[model samples]
Target: MAAPLSLRAPAATPRLPRLAGTIRQPLLGAVAVALFLLSWWGATASGMVARLFLPSPVEVAQATWRLLGSGQLVAAILASSARVFAGFAIAALIAVPLGIAMAVCGPVRAVLTPFISLLRPLPSITWIPLTILWLGIGETQKVAIVILGCWIYILLATHEATRRVDPLLVRAARNLGAGDLTVMREVILPAALPGILAGLKVTLAIAWSCVLSAEMVAAHNGLGAMIWEGKDWGDMTQVLVGMVAISLTVLLADLVATRLERALLPWERHRRH
Candidate 1:
């Protein structure tokens, strides 16, 4: 007798395609990096580029090792990381609630929209002169620069994310006897969270850039300070090492943010697969 179609087991999902996709992405990235290094090494070896102007990979690696051994690299990392964290935390604290309020309340939006628009167009670097004048080249100045550079973007992003939340969800929550705070907490926030997270990831990167810029101009110690000192002394290798350090730090931060996002929005991960 023929078995009923509904009762038959579903066809087994193929694992090979998923496995290949997982392997392919990193494999391609590794290949590209290898090729870039090979080209850079070739250029240096053939004397196509002056070693003083652009140090070879080997020289840069040696400088990195020396910095690591002397603990200067670790010190710079800590200084820069401290400023970044302090400023970013303050920005997040102020921006999130204020942004949500702006989105949910017309009076708040009308008051803040013009201020945000005026500041949003300014670059982080442009504030350096004023910050130095106001804050006097201290750590506070550095932190303030990062705050100014980051908060506007975060506020705008949060406002937009909150505004994008579906009205239907709020209405449904209200229908279910939810109050203003309850609807906001349960419906609007959850719906807006994915966008808010994406914005945070981007704004964190901007914070790093802002702190580095401020450090280069005014600070005595940081990755940016190291880079500036290297340039003054004509040490391309040290400059490259500082640049590499900042890049690695940003990469680590990004990885952490990505993990946090996945943990907060597991549904998005499932949908992607």
Candidate 2:
């Protein structure tokens, strides 16, 4: 009987050699960074770029080390991280549900679409003036700024993601006797989640920018304050150090987010593999 045609699903094809593939990205990133540092050193060394205007990478690294030793860097990182977490957490809580509502309910989408369209184009920095006026430059103002900067985009992205969930899946779930809530909870959410997570990663980056703008205007201890202080003093090394610190912090956040996405969507990972 031809060996009872295989009943199991076929195994997924393996990707390129695992060890090599795993190391390749970081290795290339390291090489690219090395080349950038070399070019930076060359520019400063040859006097093509004045040190006063753009300090050497070595000088910035030394300044970073000194800040690290003095505990200033740690303090700034904590402060900035807290503000970002608070703001982003709030935004996500607000946006995700509302976004799903907008996606599923025509009336809700109609009501919010106009507002989102009107506000989304305004940059994070513009909100600084109004936020300061209302919230008075405290931590509240900073967190609010981050919230405004992030929530709208996240809501819109979530709406789009949720709307993209296959209509057939919804129909199937409903036919199987799933109610609206159950259909949404089990079918829509799982399908929409991958896109929502991707959007959150981007929105988190925007949150950082918003916090920086907020801190620059009226804060004392965040990375934005550090940058503004260095600028005022014309300490290129300090300025570069603050910039590098922000970049590194964002990079770390992005890495964490990428891992989280892989964890939450294992099927996506397997498909990619």
Candidate 3:
């Protein structure tokens, strides 16, 4: 007798390997950090590298504590953080609008593209001498360097994001009797926001790096200045402490950016899931 189709057993399906647990992510990160510290300690303890060349983690901790007690570390952090915030904020304000304009207007793009192409290839460090020449060794010079370093990247990212926005959504908004401004504000901006936010996060890191280069040239108080002072005095521990502070600050900033991105782009998160 022929088996009824409804009662027939289904063909065996292929089973994929189970994905790793979410908890494994944080566990692995912790394990990696612990291993790195252990290796560093082992190297220093075993004298694989001289203490002068590579200070022990314990020595760096001690130096950090000493700096904190003296309030120098806190002050340096504040100064550098302020510069990064100021520069990044200003760049975003200018770049965001200009980038959108460039994406929408051919004339604007034609005018700016050449200059951007020429300058974008140059590293932030290359601007130090020119900035010093133009703005002198003042806070303005440092801020200018950061602006130059970050604004181009922010502009490019925003332009690409704006251009990549789905045209169908724009057309639908227009067909629904939305004006150009309405379409832009309601449809375009929101659509491009995820990319814009991602670009800003990258620009923030570039701003930090530029600030360090600026401070290296001429600055009285900043993490970069602290590092330079340490180098001058051959204090590897102090340099290590400054480096650690920079790394921690950048990590904290990135964490905040991630939270902000998730909050601002809930749709993106939902889509990803």
TM-scores, all candidates, are 0.95, 0.92, 0.90
Instruction: Please provide, for model 1 over 1-273, each residue's C-alpha lDDT reduced to its tens digit, 9 standing for 90 to 100.
Output: 997679778999999999999999999999999999999999999999999899999999999999999999999999999999999999999999999999999999999988987888899999999988998999999999999999988898999999999898899999999999999888999989998998999999999999999999998999999999999999999999999999999999999999999999987997767
Candidate 1 residue 108 C-alpha distance from true site, Å: 0.4
Question: Weakest 10 consecutive residues, lDDT, candidate 3?
Answer: 14-23
Q: What's the true lDDT of residue 267 in model 1? A: 76
Pairwise TM-score winner, candidates 1 and 3 = 1
Residue range with the least summed lDDT across 10 consecutive positions in model 1: 264-273
Ranking by lDDT: 1, 2, 3
Better of 1 and 3 by lDDT: 1
Tens-digit lDDT string for candidate 3 (1-273): 997679768986644322345567778999999999989989999999788799888888889999999999999999999989899999999999999999888999999999998999998899998888898988888888888889999999999999999999999999999998999999999999998998999889999999998898799999999999999999989888899899999999999999989999888886764
Q: Write the per-residue lDDT of candidate 2 for residues 109-202, one digit (tens) a residue.
A: 8999899889989988999998888889889999999999999989988999999999999999999999998998899999999989989999
Q: Compare the candidates by lDDT and give the number of the best one.
A: 1
Error of 3 at 110 (Å): 1.0
Residue 55 lDDT, candidate 2, scale 0-100: 91
RMSD of each: 1.7, 3.9, 3.9
Displacement of the residue 79 alpha carbon in candidate 1, Å: 0.6
